[model samples]
Target: MTPTSEAELAELISAATTPFAIRGGGTRVLNADDGPILDTTGMSGISLYEPGALTVVAGSGTPVQEIANALKAENQRLAFEPPNLNDALGTSGESTIGGVAASNASGPRRIAVGACRDFMLGVRFVDGAGNIVKNGGRVMKNVTGYDLVKLMSSAHGTLGVLSEVSLKVLPNVEFQVSLRLADLSAQQAIDAMSSALGSPFEVSGAARDADGSVLLRFEGFEASVRYRAESLMKNLAAFGAIEQIEDQETCEALWSDIRDARAFAKGQGDLWRISVKPSDAPEFLEQVQPSKTLLDWGGGLIWAELPSGTDIRAKMTVAGHATLMRAGTDNFAKLGRFHPEPTPLAKISADLRARFDPKGLFNPGLMGDLS
Candidate 1:
């Protein structure tokens, strides 16, 4: 069923007796055999954009590229830098705003301004029972009741179908620069990234590629960005000779690669997005030992690409969940996708799903057996 309007969507949901798989742009890591599909692509376009207020309200199926173009015209952007997995996922449909929110997809700059959930101000969604629910406000001072806007995010449509979302935008930085510290090992790169992040240089992006090269980004006015770049180089002198990447085109291209996980595009092994305490990454990497990896989010997020048929959890000794981001059907079925939480936490998650979707109809069991 394709829903072109919220009212129509609610009516469809209210009338349906069988389970339905939710779809928005249909470009995510999804399994198609769940149930009848409810596609939201029929509903598209930005409803309201208050650039002066740094806010935008768009229909759930509005293409992310469309919103990005609109924001670029006003020198504003989604601060969290949501990822576009078109290439990585090998999916043709463009990612939608609602889809991005539902997955809480964040890129390299997530280390700076936070995540997709952090910028979400308000949301309009239809729950499993077909009831329209709205939470939060258009501005940052929303301090009432539960923060369902955040709860719905990263839920992968297990709770509701987002019809509309209002997000807090941010102004573009006047200038930006990256410092590439080469010839360092993984641990040394993490150490440099940690030190840079802990310092007052305002490092906006940090990552260590599989080849052991580290990158640190700074953004602000031209003068400030340059000063910080030089100062950061001096501070990180112990690591190695630092190379400055002030060429706007070069910096943008490199970051775009890291942001999109271009290294793990197609033909790569199964990809996992692991989140752990930034300081604990070095220890975790020593255990999992993936074939290729990308250390990002100042070491808090580790994008590991392991060989096929490998069980990531078996090698995991750290205190973090491993998300099976990309893999073939056989691999996905063999190795569970999401990390199964401890018994206590699993019960809490199960209870939340039951409260929102008693029938276990929304993307049932993909995030774990909430059913």
Candidate 2:
């Protein structure tokens, strides 16, 4: 059913007899085997754009690229830099703004800027009881009660059907540069990245390949970026073979690919997204030792594509936190301690579900049934 308005959306929700999953462009939807998908693409629109206030209120179904383009026209951007999950999924689907916030998708810039949850200012959604609810507001400092807007940011549309959203935007940087370090061991590269991050220099992206190559990005005014790059190179000469990528097109493409995890796509085996302490990355990789891996988030995130027949859960359990990226299987990622514990939080989550979706109609069991 096409829900052109909030009341129509709520009506559809109330009439959904079978369990239904809310879909925004169907990018991340195909990741699971949810029943009876309810598409929200028809509900797209931009409700408000306050350039002076650096905030934009848009329909949840608006494509992220559309929002980005709209912001870019005014020299602004989504500070969180949410990733294009569709690219990682190897599918051609529009990544809606709501989907990004709902998935809490963050890319390389997350280390410097923030996550989707951080940028989300407000959300308007229809609960399972067919009630329209709004939280937060279009401004950043709206001291409203409960701050339920953030609660729904990464809820994956399980609690409600997001109809509208407000987000914080930032000005685009003047210039961007990437520094590449080749021929260092994983531990050495991670150490170098950590060191670079510690310095006064503003490093935006830091990543390493399995082959021990490190790539660091710094964005700012041309002079500042250049100066930082030169200083960073001199500081980490021990890592070996320093090369600066100054070409705008090349630098943007490289970082964009990294942000989308395009470099790790379609490996010889199943893919896993692992989050561990940056310092422990080398040791963890050595322990699990996947055949192919790409280290990002300054070694905090590991995209490991393990060989067939490997025990993904067991390996990940040993490595602090892990999630199966893709495997043509039912269970996508196994939750670990890094994920909120399932005791009191689980009870609270269930209570919230009882309030928003008492009948358990919206994407039940998507995040593992809190009920």
Candidate 3:
């Protein structure tokens, strides 16, 4: 059932007789189960918009495109540049603000700015008990209790169903320029990206293509971008001949592809999103040889397409976790979709899950069987 209001949403969940497949846009975490569909699309709209203060508050189900358009009109945007994974996931899942938060979906820009949780100032949601809980105020500085706002981010809707959200927005960069270094070996690519990121040029995005090319981006005033592009080239002359993609259109398209990991979308086999230290990225790649790999977040984030049933965890030497981005539930269960937590951390996670979702009513096992 679609809920149009928070009150209605609480009532629906409180009355549900069976398990639910918690869904926001049906783009990510497609369904709760075959039991009942709690589509949040109906509960959408921008309730408060203060462009001057750089804050936009909207219902959880509000379309991300709608919010982007609104922010565009105001010369502001969600700094994280969250990706629309509909294409990447091969699902027509239109991204919603709430869904983006739940997935913690950040893009190439995450290397510089932060993740979705970084800009999230506040959240309002119905917990598993159907109680409406609000945390943090709409403004950027509101803080009076436990940081549930961040706790909910990336929780995959296991904790609760978000109702409303408030976020800080930043003015869109006036100009962005991309520097490309072609045909660098994986280690060379990582080194080149690392150099550009560590320099004082203020890089906004960095990634390596499946073909082993490295891309570094700088965004800011036109002159600043140009200056950095030149400075960055001089800094990395030993890596290779650096080329420039100065046109905003091309630069944006390239970053978008990298952000969504779109190149691996239509490929065969399972897709895994691995997070590791940027410096350790190259070494990690040596252990896990995938059919195709794309590096983003300045080599800190790796997206690999390995054949289904591949032993993913066994291929890692660095301290990092591999998440099965696209896979069957049974295989995920066998392979452990998320990184296995250590004993102490596992205990804390189990306590949190049990306390918040005691009845196991919300998207059962969505966050995995922590207990």
lDDT of each: 0.85, 0.79, 0.84
Top candidate on lDDT is 1
The TM-score obtained by model 2 is: 0.92
Best candidate according to TM-score: 1
What local lDDT score does residue 95 receive in model 2, on the 0 to 100 scale?
A: 88
Estimate the TM-score of every prediction: 0.96, 0.92, 0.96
Indicate the worst ten consecutive residues by lDDT in candidate 1: 138-147
Candidate 3 CA-lDDT value: 0.84
Task: Return whichever of 2 and 3 wins on TM-score.
Answer: 3
Pairs in clash, predicted candidate 2:
none
Candidate 1 — which residues are off by over 4 angstroms?
none
- The local lDDT score (0 to 100) that residue 282 gets in candidate 1 is 83
- Reference-based lDDT, residue 120, model 3: 87
Worst 10 residues of 3 by lDDT: 28-37
